[model samples]
Target: MTSPALTKDAIRAKALELGFDAVGFAPATLDPKHGERLHAYLDDGRHGTMAWMESRAEQRISPDALWPDARTVIVLGTNYGPRTDPTAIHALKDRAAISVYAQGKDYHDVVKKRLKALGRWMVEELACQIKVFVDTAPVMEKPLAQMAGIGWQGKHTNVVSREFGSWLFLGEVFTTLDLEPDRAEVDHCGTCTACLDACPTGAITPYQMDARKCISYLTIEHKGTLDPDLMAAMGNHVYGCDDCLAACPWTKFTKLHTEPNFLPRVELTAPRLADLAALDDTEFRQVFAGSPIKRTRRNPMVRNVLIAIGNSKARRLKEVAEALSEDLNESVRETARWALQRLEKP
Candidate 1:
């Protein structure tokens, strides 16, 4: 068993060899007071229908509360920085704008596999007990990542690395081994309002975001019909929105991810919205097989497509929306109806 006194550089080097862009260590006992803002964000309904966040609020606030035996958190970062500007697709009225994060494989699967591999190495080399977690875990990863010196949390609430910009995906390994902690990263956002100014939905304000107004949440997390305000703000995004992330000036320093799995598929980079709108249940399944898009389910994807179709203000999409006006999913039908009203009938 490697001693708790193992040098931080050794472990970080191991993680970097594993293709992680950055790595840092922190004590598992993160301050509970650190989560007061999370409680406030949830209490204010800023999280929208992501009620599970509130349900796990207590555990999310205290990592020791989540895993009492855990004494160290090994925060690891993988840069998924896009090779191209993701926001450029928004101007393509006939295409669907998929968030860069989802343009490739499901990150949940890709990241979890790496976490497991790293955890196994820790168990074998350090002879330590460990637990691995990715985005789905109740753990609050962003703050912990900052505490580990991986990056600072941006105003948009996504972790931003000066090296990777807003394109880093975080995962953590909680270990029974007591390791030295890194100096926490501080807010480098300064007076810049690039993310705030670029947000079409005005979801970003200083250091907080209203998830109800976040297109990412509305399109991917919110299940039911979005209000007119949200619908109008969504523009042509069908899966998730990256306006705030793309607007970060730090992006200029980004080194494109070398991970083959994180690269965008040729067809998905900017798919024709009309083609996605035409998908039926079977075809939707076939199209998004093993992809993260299935998390929102086929109906919701279609629903988002309808909203984008409406927002495109394209006369050709009128028929596309019309075909979906009587969809089995009531919300999809409702959104299609709303879309129809936006298009010129003649």
Candidate 2:
């Protein structure tokens, strides 16, 4: 086993060498205020349909609650910044606008594989016990990342890196080794309301968010027909919304990511809503193979596509929405009806 004094630097160097854009260390504990905010959010039903978040509330409050033996957390950030503006697709009402994060191969697979590699190295070299997590676990990654000094949580409630902007994919390595913690990052948002103002559905209010009103949550996590007002506010976002992230001024410092795994696929960049509406279950699975969008599955995907079609004023997509009026899923069928009704209006 290596000396305890050398572990922190060694781990940081190894993580950077392994393609992580940013790395930081934080203790296993969390501030009381974070827990209080989480409880308040949950009590207010801000998490919406995500019941799992509530199930693991205590564990998510502090890393120690999840693993008492964990002495420190190693946070990793991978930059997936886009070459083009993510919000630009909103202008092309006939095209489907998938979120920038979902435009490539699934980030969970990419970030987790790298995290496992780092965990294995720590176990082999430093003889430390470790567990790795991507988004699947009950970890509070954003707050932990902020505490580790990788970035601050912006007013939009997503991490904003000074160097990588709003484009980081986060994962964590919890270890028994007690490494020195990095100074926590201070909030740099400073009176900037760009993210809040960019929200189409008024889901964001400074640092807090109502997931029920968020387009990203509505299109992905939501399991039923959406409110007509929210559907109209969603614009052409068929998968996830990037309006708040794109509006952040910090993004100006980020360069396009060169990672092959994160580069946007041509088909997802700006697909025709008509083409997306025509994707049957098998075709939906095939097109989104190895993508995060596949997790949303065909039913909800079709439902979201139908909503986008409704918001699109293009007369050409009217028939596309009509064909799905009797879709097997009630949400899809309802959204299709809404789309037909919307398209019929002048």
Candidate 3:
């Protein structure tokens, strides 16, 4: 009832034809060393308040544990490299610096659509069972991507490609087909500490990250109020941070991504801190509709915007911070007070 098994080359060609920039096959099972590293990271409490990492440890470390029937993993990368310097917004003190990844339509929506297309192809052609995943799953995508030879996890702990640098969005398809695995990529980050040195909050060391101190984690994931020190270091990054990713030397080989869905939206690329800080729940939802920033919601986003306003030291925005000092959300109110105090300082 099924067509004959397709060659790895055929699948790779199909993925490219579907607009994926990188494709490779890897065994569904992960190397034990990778699992060990994850255990150690979780043990050290480096994941911050992301409790799912602890709860989902078993499924995340082993693909077999997640889906025992999976024999081959098809790793796919879509390029979302920025057309301009992503770090340039920092110099414009009043504007919020959103991470390059969040500047457009949500990647989960964009990447998953392609993954399902690829999955449907495999089912129709080989009659194989397949499961597709993007970041919505607990799969260790960066490690699996390295195993698939698409790229290696660099010193910053994000996968870096020779072709796309730090700009690839990873997704995977786990299937019953036993395709030949590609040679695992070796680390190309020798002696490079650019990502470490570039981190304003020192969240990274050689190849490890402490999410508690990461600006991206603080701005996007952490709930409630933030530490004053971390808030001060956040600069104008209101949604997500990109300093470490933008600092990678591997990015010299980066080419602008052609995907229109991943292109930066004009407003998100240079959102004014004052405008963002003033957004009500409904306004926030409307403005960030269809964007990743929508998940962040209003209170936390306003909290982050307040921190950026505090760091701005532009006394003109002091009244903006004061206006939110009595916000209904305790966290927003506290952050607004902090911003007001910081702005009042010399």
Candidate 4:
């Protein structure tokens, strides 16, 4: 007697039932062509201070190289599209322009918990070896996502879905099950420079990104004083920037995510720059307890607030910027000096 096989449709159904917005599968044997691109990007020093991306370049490009036993890779997408226009805060100079993705609970916790649920289900039903990965791993999720038909990597270098637009949070599950793969999505962004023209720092060049000039990198991963030109271009974005992502035309199709955990907290939407600048380490930790902003630390965050105030030309924040000018951290003080100069300009 022949038993029924575990089908791709069945796996996808289960994944969707588990609350993953979109799901697709691809062979673990993804093409290694991206490895060459990674080397070129790193060699040009385009990655800037993100040395970790360079350190794990090998495991990042080649899925088979990362895990030999993996035969199928299940790629998942969770939409974190904003309930409101992400760009609206820019006009409110006194408020911070936090990236929409970070305005809610951390996706790592949301997606990883869901991945574990799906993985455990597969292990019991199909009896396959499995591994789950969030962004913590060296996985090239964007390329792998393109391979799995989740979406095409758009001009901004983010996976853009026609359905969810540029708001998908990606996760991957590696399994020994040899399920049929989905057909890859072709590049749909034809002659559209919306994301490119919209970048405040011009980080996106056609399909390639210069992470050195990227505002997200500047405000997040970057550890020291921002370049003078980059600081001027940063505007009021304190934690991360989303100009490119919000500019994608496909975002019109995106809907507000219904998951309670993914919903934006009221305070993160457009927090007062003065309030943020006043946050001590203890207060900062308490306010951003489960938030991704906590990783940016006190000094850099304060540095950003001062810069935003300087750019706003609000006389009130001059005192705040003045106080931060003598901050203990050299980077913070450097930014504070720049802010003071911007404010002091006649």
Candidate 5:
């Protein structure tokens, strides 16, 4: 294997050729205060049911701990911006709002494959040892991307690139290759409270997020019964919520995704709550076959639909709620009972 010295520009070109929207490099080092802040956030019970987050405390802060030989951290961003505001479905109150990210194929598989291809190309061309990650490991990808100059961590705590907005999914290539690092982007979220105020559950606070109060966690990561207070506030969001990400001013620069797999499915886009409420296990698997929504399985999804039907102003969904009252899943049954009560009142 011939060792050709790899420059950051050369790597960026290869990344573009490989279909990544943005690429940036950073030294494999930990942010001094990030660990402390993360610990504080966890200590406050902010991570909710995500026990995995607390388990990998050291690796989350130090990239070197993940792979000691990694000299350069190449952060890649793939944009998944929708053609329209995902929140537009809210007006159709009888429909369930799926987060834009989950409306398409799971990004984990899509991004990891691309990163592996890029890594293989790098190994063959530059003779570098590399490992790829796409939200799979303990890597604190957002801060690393910010440090690498791919983007800045906006008030919403997600990476926001000037070129791609907040709609980009982050992936990383940890390599032994020595590469020049890019200058970090300066924070551009000054005076912007749109995302903070837009959160239905008020999950965002400065640079922090309380996952316990986040709809994404409640509907996805959370198992068993949900807090009555938060469930009532969930509105029609059946899966993940994107209120913060969608409210960012930086999204003005967002463009339609080039990946065909990311295009919203007709059935998923503002899916009628009544239809979702009717999904048995088999139908649920078939409908969400290639979608990220499959992660929630049938029970939680039905539970979410019940919550949405309860909140709906559509009289038609009242029967849907009543029908789900005897759902096999206890959680779904309880939520359905609540929905039935709400629908019966008015």
Candidate 6:
């Protein structure tokens, strides 16, 4: 086995060679403060309909608890910044705005594949035992990345890197290898409330977030009917909302992602709400292949499209909303009916 000291630098060099934008190391430990805050968020019913967040509380906050044998965590970041302003779609009110992250291939798949390859290299080259984790695992990746000096978790609850801004996807390799830990990055969000103020649903509150009111959570994770007030306030954001992310001044450092897989699909970049609202199950599956939108299934997506159509200033979408009134998905049909009613009013 290679000496622990020598392996740390080797691992980092290999990570960069593997196409990861940033990599750092941290000792596996529990984040008690984050745990308490998460508990409070759940206790206050702030997670909305995301019951799974409460169910996995223990695993979410502690790395040692996730895998007791984990000694070192190698955190990796992949940049997915867009080439243009994500909010530009708002000018075309008849279109739906999908978050930049979901505008390309799913990060979980893309990041995980790279992580697994790195894990294999560690085993063969360093003779280390390791486990790879993306969002699929119970790892608190943002906090781990912060501890590894990749970046600090800004008040918006996302990691902010100097080079990549807040436009990176994080993954981890929890290994039994005793690697040197990196210096933790300091928080640079002093007195800045731009992200908090920009949130359309007011989800951000300093270091905390009321996930119930987050448009991303409401539109994607919250499975049932959303409150009419929240739906109305969502504007044209049909999938996930990026106001908090886009509002970060740190993003000024961001450059367009080099990964071809992350480039925005022509159809998804600014898809018309009329076309999206018209997707049946088969059409939805076909349109969203390899995209993160497939995760929500046709029902939620179409429902969101109807909500966007309702909020659209374009009078042309009235017919689009009317056509969706008979959608096969009851949720889609219901939201379409509501949209048509709102659009038809004088």
Clashing pairs in 5: none
lDDT of each: 0.87, 0.91, 0.92, 0.87, 0.86, 0.86
Clashing pairs in 3: none
lDDT of 1 at 18: 81
Candidate 6 per-residue C-alpha lDDT over 41-128 given as tens digits, one digit per residue, 9 for 90 to 100: 8889988777778788888888888888999999999999888987778788887899999988888899999999999998888777
Residues forming the 10-long window of minimal summed lDDT in candidate 6? 1-10
Q: Which ten residues in a row have the lowest lDDT in candidate 5?
A: 1-10
What TM-score do all the candidates reach, one by one? 0.97, 0.98, 0.98, 0.97, 0.96, 0.96
Cα miss at 66, model 3 (Å)?
A: 0.4
TM-score (C-alpha) between model 3 and the true structure: 0.98
Give per-residue CA lDDT, model 3, range 292-325, as digits (tens).
9999999999999999999999999998999999
Preferred candidate (lDDT higher): 3 or 5: 3
Candidate 3 lowest-lDDT run of ten: 1-10
Go through the candidates in order and give the clash count of each: 0, 0, 0, 0, 0, 0
* Model 1 lDDT on a 0 to 1 scale: 0.87
Query: Which tens-of-lDDT digit does each residue in 238-264 have in candidate 4?
Result: 988889988899999997788888788
Writing each residue's lDDT as its tens digit, candidate 2 over 1-346 gives 3665577889999999999989999999998888999999999999999999999999999999999999999999999999998888988989899999998899999998899999999899888899999978988899999999999999999999999999999999999999888999999999899999999999999889999999999988989888999998888888989999999999999868889998889999999888888888899899999999998988898888888888888878888888999888898899999999999999
Assess the local accuracy of residue 263 in candidate 3 as a C-alpha lDDT between 0 and 100.
80
| 190-280 per-residue lDDT for model 5 (tens digits) | 9989999999888889888899989898888888777777877889999998888889988888888989879888888888898898999
Off by over 4 Å in 4: 1-6
Candidate 5: which stretches are off by over 4 Å? 1-6
**Candidate 4 at 299: error in angstroms?**
1.5
- Give the total clashing residue pairs for model 1: 0
Query: Can you give the lDDT of residue 189 in candidate 1?
Result: 90
